[model samples]
Target: MSATATTTVTATDSPRKGRSGARPLHLPGGISLRVERRALAVGVLLTAAALALAVVLIGTGDFPIAPWDVVQTLLGNGTPANDFIVNDLRLPRVLVALLVGAALGMAGGVFQSVSRNPLGSPDLLGFGYGSAVGALVVIILFKGGATEVAVGALAGGLLAGVAVYLLAYKQGIQGYRLVLVGIGASAILIAVIQYLITKAQMIEATRAMVWLTGSLAGRDWAQVWPLLAVCAVLFPLVLGQGRALRMMEMGDDAAHAVGVRVERTRMLLMLAAILLTTAASAAAGPISFVALAAPQLARRLTRSPGGNLLTGALMGSVLLMVSDLASQRAFGADQLPVGVVTGLVGGIYLLWLLVTERRAGRI
Candidate 1:
């Protein structure tokens, strides 16, 4: 063989027989786990901030416990009034906010990672609308209560997700196609929801109206239990599939080359995301923007290339808790829906993302 050809053979073969049985030198998917370390820090900071905001708001309630009193109550040493304000009312609300936010964040992170698009979220993809459609159907048709409505929402979100997947699969499930199809599906569901709202009595509409806005008000342990069920089931399932999800960002063929079941993995992740979103929506009526905004904010905070699931969940919880606080305090007579507050902020952020993408020539 020619010297150059011999050299090329040696160079190619050498790495295939390294000290530890000849391994690939490259990081998986041209991405490094090193970046995710900072994600942990960002998640912690965001969680602390969220807790602080919740505490501050709890202390400033109608009863007005001091910060110290709030701490004492949290630690089981405060006055009865302080305990009542923090543990009974505000604590449950905060816990719900955190749970809902975490679910949205996790769902959003999964969707964004799967789609490889920052804009792909449960809210934007119509999953939230699916939940609404389901809940509305139960509320209107069956006169179901909150629990029943929640189940309907879950079923609706899953059905919508499946429909989107089937529709988007015709062309090999391109990211943009999936997003577009999901958006269209969501519009149809929204129309159905509107129709249901119109047909229902005003009293019935009152419940739907409150649910539509995604408020955490009146969410006691009952709502919290269902959310817990969802988290308990879905959280670990998603985490277990993280490696497969990471593999998928490199496109189907590449993921498959690494022994990842690309289609199955994507489908499972999508389903999990749907379940989480549905559970959250059922609990709090499609609380807006946490699913859309948290992951993006997490990426920014961690200075990572894209979303981190853990960090996104923490950021989401914080965002929701802070929004809830604002809603409770900012309006004197009428407490605004937490979802509305998140939607306003998230909408602006979405616009900003669009502008940034355009500026970066990604459009």
Candidate 2:
């Protein structure tokens, strides 16, 4: 090749490379193409619909503010009574639901995506139980409230998740093996929860009942702070690994060939997922089904073969908001545990999933 031609090519390529580095650009629809963008749009629309449902449900309580009043109060232009009811009373509850639901949705997405199992979720795979066990230990044994409970829950969840990993590591981590181990671990943890309940004094047990069953009633800023912390840290950490995770999901050999550190990436993602789930549980005891359902729901709505983390988070927020609203208004003033409402819905969905899988011989 002529020196002049080579020099010209190098000069042209250098500016293009420099611009790519400087901008680090992403398209409006993200890295993937049209299908992903369309699915993302659908998930977002569904989430918005769910949020609207939550507003109606929340406003229909005993002191009853209309939807317009709720909007007015939200915009800082409503009557004092309406403002207090909507903002002071219901707003905090809604915030907690959104936080917890978003955390669970992302946690579920992380677990299922990292483990490569659609059935793997924090609640289903024992991470929730681990957090619950930890929080219960703190509340029951040490008489600690929010702060200690949060720490204990995070510790317990990580420990339980590690235990499941070790047990399933007999040959090496495979998706199905990890899930089966998690199921067994969850069963044992449930027994432990029952034992703790039986051993506690009645008053403590009654208070713990709220934790065990998962209720958003009387939730104040204390619970909100921990969730905020988790969201702040965990989301960034997980998001930073988005490119790495996308590669790892394609299997270890393929990922390794692409200059990825498979084991380390998996471990980090697993730990992040555990921490997110633990923090949510600590904030509000295993709120149930949202963790198990949000990712699948996101995937189905988006028609994506795998979970979309952002979409899943939105779906989760909507699920919890709607469910908590239902629990609060379905009966009366006091409100049922949000867990009960989610459990009923989640359980039915789970059963249907099993039936479909069995019929298709996918199980």
| Tens digits of lDDT, candidate 2, 1-363 | 000010110101123434322223245554421223355356558667766865775586678878887887788999999888887787767778888998999889888877787788987789889988888888888899778877888899989989987887754478888899999999999999889989998877887787889878777777787788889988767755655566666777877897877778778878888888888887778888788889888777654444467678788888888787778777776778889999988999899988887898878
lDDT of 2 at 137: 88
lDDT of 1 by residue, 1-363 (tens): 000010110111223234412223336556322222344455567778877887787786667888788888899999887777787787777778889999999899889887778888998888889888999888888899877988898899888888888998964567888889888998898889999999999888988888898888877788877788889898777766765666577678977897987888888888888889988888888887788888887767665443367677777888888888888888886888898999899889889999999999987
Q: What lDDT is reached at residue 257 by model 1?
A: 95
Q: Evaluate residue 265 in candidate 2 and report its C-alpha lDDT on the 0 to 100 scale.
A: 75
- All candidates: CA RMSD in angstroms? 8.5, 8.4
lDDT of each: 0.77, 0.75
The pairs that clash in candidate 2 are: none
* Model 2, global lDDT: 0.75
